[model samples]
Target chain A: MSLPPPAARPRRAPLALRVAAHEDLGGGLRWLTLAAPDVAAAAEPGQFAHVRCGGGLGPDGALGTRRAYSLADADPDRGTVSLLYRVWGRGSVWLSQRRPGEVLDVLAPLGTPFRLDPHRTPVFVAGGTGVAPFIFLARRARQKGLRPLAFVGARTAAELAGGEFLAAAGAEVAVATDDGTAGFAGTVVDLVVRALEETAAAGGLAGPSPALYACGPHAMMAALAAACAAHGWPLQVSLETPMACGIGICLSCTVPGPRGPGFYRRCCVEGPVFDAREVAWE
Target chain B: MSDLTTRLGPLTLRNPVLLASGTAGFGRELAEYLDLAGLGGIIVKGTSPSPWYGNPGPRTVETPSGLINSIGLENPGLRHFLEEDLPWLRTQGATVIVNVVGRTVEEYAAVAEGLAGADGVAALELNISCPNVKAGGIQFGHDPRLAAEVTRAVKAACGRPLFVKLSPNAPDVPAVAEAVLEAGADGLSLINTYLALAIDVARLRPVLPSVFGGLSGPAIKPLALRWVWEAHARFRVPIIGMGGIREWSDAAEFLLAGAQAVAVGTASFTEPRTAAFVVEGLRKWLDERGFATVGEVVGLAHRAIDGEEAVPLGQS
Candidate 1:
């Protein structure tokens, strides 16, 4: 995938953002509101920020820093960007210890965002923290006068994030939990398949069939991609891969492209967002 | 204040810390994390005569405290760099060293010739050792004659001080160093990433799309240090040592091994301000040890064994 010229999209540096608020969403998850006006102003649904942890003392404390998290919500006027993250490793553990009013190093407006065509009814599917970007997409759609439909899946009730926010925004949200502690008693992909089928049976996919957007585990996305392909809906996905630098320089985040298995694209630059069908999911 | 001024031949660095090329893309990618101008110097990503998309993806894999990559020297070509990136880089304050690569000797000379009189361009690093690309990369690095030829060719066309980046993958790193120095190389950068590979047992195939990648980080530090140590012992040319430098201690090891300066590569990935942090650490280490100028610390390990210096402090 050829990236946009550097002139078109100016790269942003990590902003020393103050933590406006912090909420503990248990099961090792966090909801952070960062005071990064620059990021809030430029952020889009799928693009993320690279957050560097361990802002302890001098430069040494900042070593082995940073992880990318999709923006869950952004308010340009309020100068805030929201993120929901699970404590997965040492980095997250360090991030978790951060208190309000503390400054964290954050690089924003990174990668391509999930595109929302106002005419197309947006169907967002997410698993776990994958629900992050949809908060922005949902709000953006509402601003454009579109009421979105969403499906969120988690292993259990504790793992689900942003369900309340989606509902508050007047979205038709369907929740699925593997343990049956939530809406649908099975996998999210199964719920998604049923939702599409029911919508189609009710009036032959009337008025712009839903455009599919998903972000989650690789397996979950692959399943969604196949489902979208079968139903003939345009699908976009945000991929999560290991990255050294969230910029184009490192070449660490690679994924196969539409060119076939042999050709690879830098995920950090080429995409964190890609057409679901274009990605060569092995 | 402990002086960090470093001299690599005619080129004088603000300090001895450098952002290794390819690691810091054109010096802008890491701008968000640290002040780019604060570091000693920046060896921007390798550029060729024209744009190169680089190798197929699956370009990197992590091992231990290191990273291996097959980025194939992907760059926007010399013209684009000179026209677009250079103006912004010059404003950043730190010295900028343009790293040039090519599929052929003429292309190398042409790139250098283009940057010959560019303002803010401090030096040029000849990356004849990139092992990711299918051709003209490690081939020139491993061959003494080819390495010297490329060095001589670029040095003639480029007016600025030229540093030949030596490949640890060479048949004899010292030989390559000596050849390049003889061919008018102003300095040297030792131990580009070693050519390496990895396999996914589950997939039962090579992990990287290129099948082989260059290994970097702490995993290759000792190995890179050996070459830097050897090359420094044999030549007067200042050597910039890099492989896996995560912290100040790693930078100290390279200095002790005889590198006049240390380039932070994979470490920058971990911390964009790693070089700056290293500069801070080096300063702290120096002042605490009763040393002043960082120049005073260069090759300190080579001078003494046990508790003495072959030449006492301030005597040399």
Candidate 2:
């Protein structure tokens, strides 16, 4: 059993892309569409764009350190790429304030994106804004004549972003909310485990083995990792870290590797998406 | 067009803007964004005798106008560099300055010895100033005698022009600069990141696993400038001033404060083409000021002062 080869690292340059559309999306979520022909053409699902927020080449330009956001959608025909982000900090706040037609400095199609194996059934688990990349993933999976099963979780129905987007992208969407305002009134991981058990009992997983793909709060991903390990499922997880350079140079975004206790891998180059077995979960 | 060509001791560069060590990652990543041969030089990430895992995450935090990193000088060992990175960098036509790190003086000397006759290695920078590591980094930088000892060891091991990087955490930076220069160091890369810390309020603990990290960015520019000014005023060696140089103005300040060359550090994280932009901007700045070459601007600020005393503007 040889491991699958890693995704090829994208060659990127900073582009001053024009914002085509911006939406509030209520409940703290903001969706942005940028006219980026090259990025839209080359970006794979789970790859991200490092965007410079707020300050624009001025004396306070130092305040504009690039923040990484997953590329949520790409329309090659439209020559556009979209990002879904929560206004979490100063950087995002700056990003949220941008209007349509405004220019953004972006370094795109970065990091190792998620690779879908056609031999395995694609199952995606997302928590909160972690649903961003899955939209792109679901769309790509659909294009390949695959029906992706997506489990999306949030604190409430109002915060549940991308569930509708996932459905529109041809994925079978399952929603879980902590406040019981959504489909499954429990944790998404628990929902996934229950679904897996029921599917196993019904022999619904007979044709192809289900592979778990996730991006979420650390605790949720950890729980999902445990569940996948129990079911002997191969899992791929998209991780989030405080990143300075979205490129591999700074080595700021590192996750502990499965090699041993001290060994680590660069998140930017190695992956934002990795085999759950490759990560040393604490 | 004004000449951007400048010399840092034994190394002659096309310009005075080099990518700081650790920020540019051996010229591969940044090469995708900018032309490698276009900049002054590239000082790659610190290379150790053996591979270092560095500190565990969360390794970086963004404060006001600054970033704190506890990467602990993590690098692929010397063998990997000589095998994989060096040849690629050479093909890019980059002026490669290898920033060498080690756990002991012997290890530093060994890396220097390995790169002694390596192709395309323009110089060697001894990284005794990295604050994140426990064993060898700042431990050598803080003490003048140890700083000189490592400098002498590497100087003896390699025939390349040696520049000893000084730590801002060092109690007396000039003292260490003096010691290294006396020990046969050709130049100095002044003011690596400052030792700093950030706490997580929600978790009620330190943000970085290392507890402390080195702070860099615009926050430390003034501190770095003052040190460069002092070092240049006292010593007659070429200095590569860094720590928070983001743009042409910041690069100009370093040169005015007596740095023959400037390295763009944290700025590169935001914009990969910052060093190239600085190079272009500096040339235009010199042309606008009627200066023919970058050397004319080096230490120009210090020349305005009269014999160690402050001379006010228009009184010189």
Candidate 3:
């Protein structure tokens, strides 16, 4: 089977963009829209923005590091790019407190983006805030005249953030909660596997096989990868490794490479997204 | 305008702001965001005789105003660097200082010897202070004898000017400095990340997989500055001071502490344009102070304490 070639790496720079809007999506999730025309125009699905969070541009800044966040959506004509993040750390708290019109320093359209194959059906799996990139992915798939399927998981219904947005983007979203306070009583991986098995049993799984796209906690993605491997499906995973530079310079963000044990690839430059098989999941 | 030109012994830099090794990778990565030809120079990531895969997952953890990283000196090896990265760096008009690492003294000499034939390489910075790697990194750096042995071997193998990167974890940094300098190193690169660790309270485990990573960023600035000052006071060789240099003021402090040139390391991770920004800000700072050149500021803090007219040893 021919794999999709790597996404074209777009040129990026640190842009000082104004916060166009901010929405507290409840459950600590925040939706921030920035007026970044260049970034919106250049961003592709699975790409991220490195945002300088808190304090002034100095060594003594509250958080002297830049935090990486996936682009939730981008509108080139509107000159806006949106980020969906959970206010978990000091950086995210500072980002959440940012008022409209406050300028933010961001390095956008970084890392290799997801390679969407036109011939295959798109199936997205996300856990918690991992749903951030899938909204953009679903929108892109819809634009390409493909029906995207998404499985979103969280601890509870209130914790779920992106399923509604995914649905609005024309994706069929299935949700699973750990407490069974949402869609499926079991894990998202179990839900997807059951759905796929039932479809095959009913002979409704004909035509080109569906390709799985995933982003979530490590355990969730690893389980999904195993299921996809068993079903002979293609899977691509977006990793959320701790990164210092969203660019390739700092080799701080690394994942085990497919080469062998001890071999690793830079998650920043090589990919925030990689073919599931290319990663040596623990 | 104040002259930003900085001379480190035999090497002359257009400016004193250089992107530190490991942080800059090859010039190819930062070249996308900033103009390579504009800065003083680019110290490429530590390259070995052969490719090293480095440490496992979770290589970095963020601390208060700092970052701990166990990158283990991962590089594409000497062959790939000379064949692929060097040509592009040369074309960009970047003064390339290749940081060499090895698992053995022979390996260090081999990589240095290999780069000796490369066209664009301006100098070699021996990285004997990488704390993340187990085999040959800080192992050579902590002991003055081992540090001098590797420095002597590389110096014999290559014709290029050698700068030995010092480790803060060393029991006596000045001892290592004296050993490498006595072994024929042209200059010194002070403070290659402090050996440190961070525990994840939630998981009750170390943040980095390697357990102990090198701590960088503003948290270690004072420690790095102290080492630079001590080394400068004891030795006459040029010192490339680095460790949490985030802006022009930080760079200025390093110059005052007696660093001939300053490298921006972790700050580049926060802002890729930091090195270039420092170049401009430092020039403006000097001009405002009525200093004619960057050399005028080098080691000025020492003179203030000594209460005597002191010559900048770096110029010698």
**What tens digits encode model 1's per-residue C-alpha lDDT throughout B263-307?**
999877755667878989988877677677777777777667545
Name the DockQ score for candidate 2. Answer: 0.42
- For residue A79, give model 2's deviation from the true position in Å: 2.1
Better structure of 1 and 2 per TM-score: 2
Candidate 1 versus truth, CA RMSD in Å, comes to 5.9
- A282 Cα displacement, candidate 2 (Å): 1.4
Per-residue accuracy of model 3 over A1-282 as CA lDDT, tens digit each: 432221223434688999999998888999999999989999999999989888533445657678899999998899999999999887898888999999998888788999998998899999999999999999999999888889998888898887888998889999998899989988889998898889878885664568889999999999999999999989999998888887888888888866853377778888899999988877
Each candidate's fnat, in order?
0.37, 0.56, 0.69
TM-score of chain B of 3: 0.97
* Cα distance off (Å), candidate 3, residue A129: 1.5
Candidate DockQ scores, in order? 0.27, 0.42, 0.47
Supply the DockQ value of model 1: 0.27
How many clashing pairs in candidate 2?
0
List, in order, the clash count of every candidate structure.
3, 0, 0
Candidate 1 residue spans exceeding 4 A from truth: A1-44, A49-66, A72-110, A127-129, A139-145, A152-170, A174-209, A216-235, A254-266, A274-282, B283-292, B306-316
How many angstroms is residue B309 displaced in model 1 relative to the true structure, after the best TM-score fit?
4.0
Q: What lDDT score goes with residue A121 in model 3?
A: 85
